[model samples]
Target chain A: MNILAYIIQKEFIQIIRNKAILPMMTVLPIVQLIVLSNAASNEVKNVNVVVVDMDQSESSRTLNHKIIANDRITLVATSFNTNEAHFYLQENTSDIVIEIPPDFENDYINGKQPKIQLLVNATNGQQAIVGSGYLKAIVASFNAKLIQKVIPDISISKQSNTTISSRYWYNPELKYTHFMAPGILAQLTALLTIILSAMNVVREREVGTIEQINVTPLKKWQFILGKLIPFLCIGLVLFTVGIIASKLIFSIPILGNLPLLFGYTTLNIIAVLGLGLLISNFADTQQQAIFVAFFFIIIFVLMSGLFTPIDSMPKWAQQLTVGNPLAHFISVSRKVLMKGSGFWNIRFEFLYTFILAFIFNGLAVWSYKKQV
Target chain B: MNTPIAIELDKLTKRFGDFIAVDAITFKVKKGEIFGFLGANGAGKTTAIKMLIGLSKPTEGMGKVAGFNVDTEPEKIKKNIGYMSQKFSLYDDLTVVENIQFYGGIYGLSREKIKEKTTEILEELELTEVSKSLVISLPLGWKQRLAFAISMVHDPEIVFLDEPTGGVDPRVRRQFWETIYQVAEKGRTVFVTTHYMDEAEYCDRVSIMVAGKIEALDTPHNLKQQFEATSMDEVFLKLAR
Candidate 1:
């Protein structure tokens, strides 16, 4: 135990002495939080629209006014011919184009259904889908108004037998930042801890310091633990920084228990640090350790259900996510922060993370050879 | 006088697949003796030292380091020995004092003991003025001496030095041998490996290794007489050829 303490002290001193890594640990997360959180937005707004009105009638003008009044649609150009509107669409000046045929108002007034054409730029699929939804809502409301004028006594609501109201739970406003902040924090914590710890042992080997340590009377477990404890502390410190950024910068609320979050974070750090040590044991050089860590971290982050919902993934992928510690932590972070989930709600995640911690750390210690 | 054996090896061998790094060899070193291990690069001096120091296991052998079995009591052997590798193993980022304190601490030395020894080592090396400076800032000769001193901080029964003075000037090399002689005079066994033939003459006894086997083992004077060579360097060339 005394030897372990000395090792930890030496490791901490070396970390502080390294001018490059110390600032990187403290600054990288903050920069990533500020930059990635704001940049990773799914909400599409201010879609440019071009209208080609050949009818020039009351109904067509009314439709045009409705499209213009909608906040999300911006009327960049008004054209009398489809050719001119096509030019705007081709130039990328407009995301959507609406064309109303001649005699549209007369046909509608005479009880004839007139056709209208909507051309949406499908290059950006999400923006095109959302822009089309706004156009549909405006046209539907216009149809409802027309029906009301034609029959004053007939009720449009009574015409529909069924009504469906959709409610979004956990996030009432569906703010992308709120959903993403916790996930990003979890990913950053895992990435930093895994990479730092993974590179540490191999770096010692490259510098020949490990030979000195190996010749000492320090036990394998003590040495591995000494290496892991410092990184675990750093992981927690990074976690705290991430939490502050999430709450202060992003306004992500923490509705669940704070202590429970920390408990899971501790377990997650153990698992990741163990994984790092395992990599160090297998890698003979710092470069090899880094490449191996990079490969695993990329896979862990992508399959961790950080950006995508696991439920939406295929069965095989969901099964793989069950083994990923990042996935478990992300689930816990999102649930506890967004949905106010308590210990009992996240008990399975805690259990799984703890088991993974044991497995990874056990494998690391077992694979680490004191003598070759 | 019958000085007890500090290190013994009976047919120690190591094999990596089909290639044999250290062939079966037997030897013994008495306590308070300077035993020089001389070998060319990749002649298996390092592999043999690693096995003795508990850093590597022998494929087939029986050995004892400081009365502890190298195969079973490696931890005990580690506790009873000090090792300095060919590469400077002290943390260059740490100060001279910090490195001493850290190595002393890992050896299970108390705070007061570490403090007392730190002062002694610093004053002995005449590094008291720059004790607080980072080890990397020190000159190579100073770093080498500091590393040697730190290895002996635990005051083990046997000290193993693998090419401890490889790249220093002749003056520094002579000074290093003075320190080794001092430690040997204190009745601690010194097991050292060196490529320099003049350094081999400084040892009380020398073993020349060739192609993973000991080609010659005797005192410098007797080996010179037996090989019809005037100096240890000529003796080494004759054995290697």
Candidate 2:
């Protein structure tokens, strides 16, 4: 116990004494939060679309007005000829084109479905899907208007059958910053703490101090646990800082239990620190340890369901994601911050993180050598 | 009993797969003795030191360090010894005082004890003025000296040094020996290994390993006479060749 405390104290002192590391660890997260929040949003607005109106009538003008009025679409260009519209599409200047045929008015008057062609760019699959929905809404609204005009004498009721009062639940506005900031905090803690602990051991080996420790009465478990505890504290500090950033800079509401979030974050730090120690035991060089740590972190962050919904992913990918601690953390953080889910709701996530922390840290102790 | 041996080994052997690192060897070091472990490149000096430190498990044989079994009581062995390796062992980014405090803390030293020891070690090394300086910024000689002192922070029964003076200049090596002498004078056992044959002369007794076997073990003077050589280096050349 004393030896472990000594190791923890040593690591903390080293962290405090190093001028470059402390500032870098603290400031990098804030800058990343600001820059990444801007880029990480799922909402893609202002899609550029061109209008090609051959009819040039009131009906065609009204349809064009409706499409442009939508916040999703922006009018980038207008053309009369199909050839000119095709040019805009080919040059990638337009994401969508609404073509009103010359016989569009005739078709409407004759009680036939109007033939308005929507040419959409499918190269960017996501943008294409969204563009199609926007175009369909405009066409549907226009068709309804035509129906009302054509059958004015007939007794009819025009009202929506059912209305959905959607409540965003956790984060009402669905701000990307709110969702991402907590997860990034978790990731930063995992990344930095693990690297430092793993490097601490590797550095000892490289510099020859390990031999000193080896000859001492320090147990392998003591050494590993000592290293793990200090890093765990560092991870928590990073988590607290991330929460502050989310509230002040991102204006993200904290809906979940703050104490619960912190508890889970602490568990996550242990799991990550265990993983780092495992890497430290495997790698003989500081460089090797760093690269291995980076590889695992990348894997954990990507499969964690931070950016995309894990449910939407393939079965195999989802199964692999189950082993990743970040996956559960990202979900749990969002649930608490966005939905304010209680202990029962987040029990499964907490269980997995706790189990992983124990298993990985145990393995680190098993693999650790007090000598040589 | 005349203060039981600090280290005792009986038929200690180590093998990495089929390659024998340290062939079955027997030796003993009395308490407070400065024992030199001398060997040529790949001559099993490191392997032997590792076994003594309880870092490596012997393929065959039994050993005891500070009266603790190498197999079951490896942890106990660690509690009783200090070690310094050939590499830069201390944290390069940590200040001298910070490193001492950390090491002292792990060894179960109280905060007051750590504070007192820090001042004593700094004063002894005349490093009080720059105790806050990062280890990386210090000269190589200074770093080596600090590393030696750090290993002794726990005040162990025996201090194992594996080529602690590698890459250090002769003046630094001499200065390092003075520190070793100081530790020995305090009744702490100094078990050191080095490629520099000149260092063997400083040991109370020396053992020369060749081809994973101890070819000679004696006071440097007696070994020189037995090999018809005036220096430890010539004695090594005669036996190694």
User: Each model's interface RMSD (Å)?
Assistant: 1.0, 2.5
Scored by lDDT, model 1 comes in at 0.91
Query: Model 1, residue A172: what's the lDDT?
Result: 87
Model 1 regions more than 4 Å off: A50-56, A76-125, A150-169
DockQ of each two-chain model: 0.80, 0.60
lDDT of candidate 1 at residue A202, scale 0 to 100: 94
lDDT by residue (tens digit), candidate 2, A1-372: 766767877778767876766765678778877877778766667588999999988888888889888988899999988889889889999988888888788788887877888899889877888888888978887887877887777565646445458888566687677777777766666777878878878877776666666665566788887777877777777777777876899787788789988888888888878988899999999999999988988888778877777998899999888679888888888788777889899998888888898989999999886654
> A295, model 1: CA deviation in Å?
1.2
- What TM-score does each model's chain B reach against the true chain B? 0.99, 0.97
Q: Give Cα distance to truth, residue A342, candidate 1, Å.
A: 0.9
Q: After superposition, how far is residue B147 of candidate 1 from its true place, in Å?
A: 1.1
RMSD of each: 2.5, 3.0
